[model samples]
Target: MSASNNTADREAKLQRNPHGDFNAVEKSRPEFEEDVEFHYTRTKDIEWVPGSGATSDDWKKHKKIAVDPYAEGRDPLNNYKLLIAGIVPRPIGFVSTESKAGIRNLAPFSYTTFVHHDPPIFCIGFASSVAAAKDTLANIMETGELTINIISEWFVEAANYTATNAPPEISEWDVSGLTPLASEKVKPPHVGESAFSVEAKLVTHHEWISKVTGKANGTLVIVEGVNFHIREDATNESFTTLDPKILKPISRLGGITYGRTTQAFEMLRPSWADEEKREEVKKILEK
Candidate 1:
């Protein structure tokens, strides 16, 4: 064999089993390269490339998989795994809460999102523990306060460390080696290292039973933001929009996998009032 063939053979042999433990795995660069980097002026740059658009005919020709989510006999575990994996990426809410006794707790939750902004509401979901309620959920219920920290690349490992399973008495903050700052609006402290942190007062919570487990295993807590703290280095002049390059936020993928926000593209929304779009739609209507 040629030298290149031998090298490829060795690489093939070194490929780790997908089921193998995390301790043994060969790291490699991402599949995409500079060729796939997002063009900032994406809409405007279309002029540079001919046939850049995907037409209705092109879309209709592609085959797809259809899933019946409410099927009577679907395996719940498989469904959950598929959902988590299929949802390309999800933001992590590095949550901080304090117990009635004042001991701190920290954990990363991916099942979280902004529910409302007028009341400045944020929602984070929790799964129950077999022996008791989740520490963070219990604390929020008792104290009606919590802090949310945005995970950045600078301290993602430390944020992940806080997710380890431990007794409620034991503080994850101590284990993470990340400092905390006393909150102005809430009793819980915000993560000192996080680029963005929010002090929220618990508005209310909804409890629900899990379909698979048939237990009261889910709790959705809604909190109204009282104060927001953003690192000056990561914010713009007005502190409205954040700079991704500086924030370097990390996101959750499927099990044990994390995603990095390394590239972005933009496309302006086409207004229906525009003459060209109106004419095009008119032509389609006539057809």
Candidate 2:
């Protein structure tokens, strides 16, 4: 072969296999070889340094590493601060109930949502730790009635204020400085500032065991909606009529972030004419 042709052939061979040495190729492709022994290292080896300062004799010394409930010299507020700060933009459920003394109470709960709509059931997971839950859940259990004030962006701050740890005798409405409107169906009054509210009757009270403490810590109250009070100009003939821009409902998110339903979109299913088009496409694909 001509020297020029031989040089071109060598260049093509080098291009095909960039690593000229097989030993170098083997080192580069370690994962591809099943015969090679793999040594896995723990993340602690890479991320943490072990020394005198890292090791602790007491559980409290390891508070920076893991959560030790019984750890001494740890501030209780530290755990609460971490939880509330980390659980960000939690959905707010503004709950209202009437005390036996005829005093009305309004509170906001993050652990609340709609479970079923057939019977129009919604749930509020209230913490028994709070004095308000004792009164609110007790009242619901006694009177079999409550109201849920749907919070929008405009009223979220006021709703959050109601979540404060308050005495049972003190009304959240009075503390938060929000007006209360009499409900048509339930004893509990709705927040006058809210754009929407639902009067519901208590259907069931389910107590749940706490995973951490193993104690019956909270109660999930299922409520059945008897009446809905929507803003006069907000509703339309069709259910799709309410504008999201006006509603501006706030949603809970991870950590301290809250979400607003600012954008809306829709998707249409296949119609009779579209089904024929789909069938034509299917035939073409089959061929």
Q: What TM-score goes with each of the models?
A: 0.80, 0.61
Scored by TM-score, the top model is 1
- For candidate 2, list the clashing residue pairs, or say none: 88-255, 88-256, 89-252, 89-253
Model 1's alpha-carbon lDDT is: 0.77
Q: Candidate 1, TM-score vs. the true structure?
A: 0.80
lDDT of 2 by residue, 1-287 (tens): 43334435544543433356856766776353224332333432233322224444576655455778546766433554466556765657788999778877777767787888888899888656322245677678878888887788767777778766566687888878888898988778888887778899988788877556576656788889998877766677665355555566777764334676655445345475565556455665577
Candidate 1 lDDT over 1-287, as tens digits, reads 43334435534553423556644443444443334322243443554322335433566777998888657887555566677778868889888999989889999999887888798999987755322456788888889999999998779889989977677899999988999899998999999999899999888878877676576656788899999999998898887887787777889988668887877777557665674455555665576
Q: Which candidate gets the maximum lDDT versus the true structure?
A: 1
Give Cα-based local distance difference scores for all models.
Answer: 0.77, 0.68
Error of 2 at 177 (Å): 1.6
C-alpha RMSD for every candidate = 10.1, 26.6
What lDDT is reached at residue 122 by model 1? 95
**lDDT agreement of model 2 with the native:** 0.68
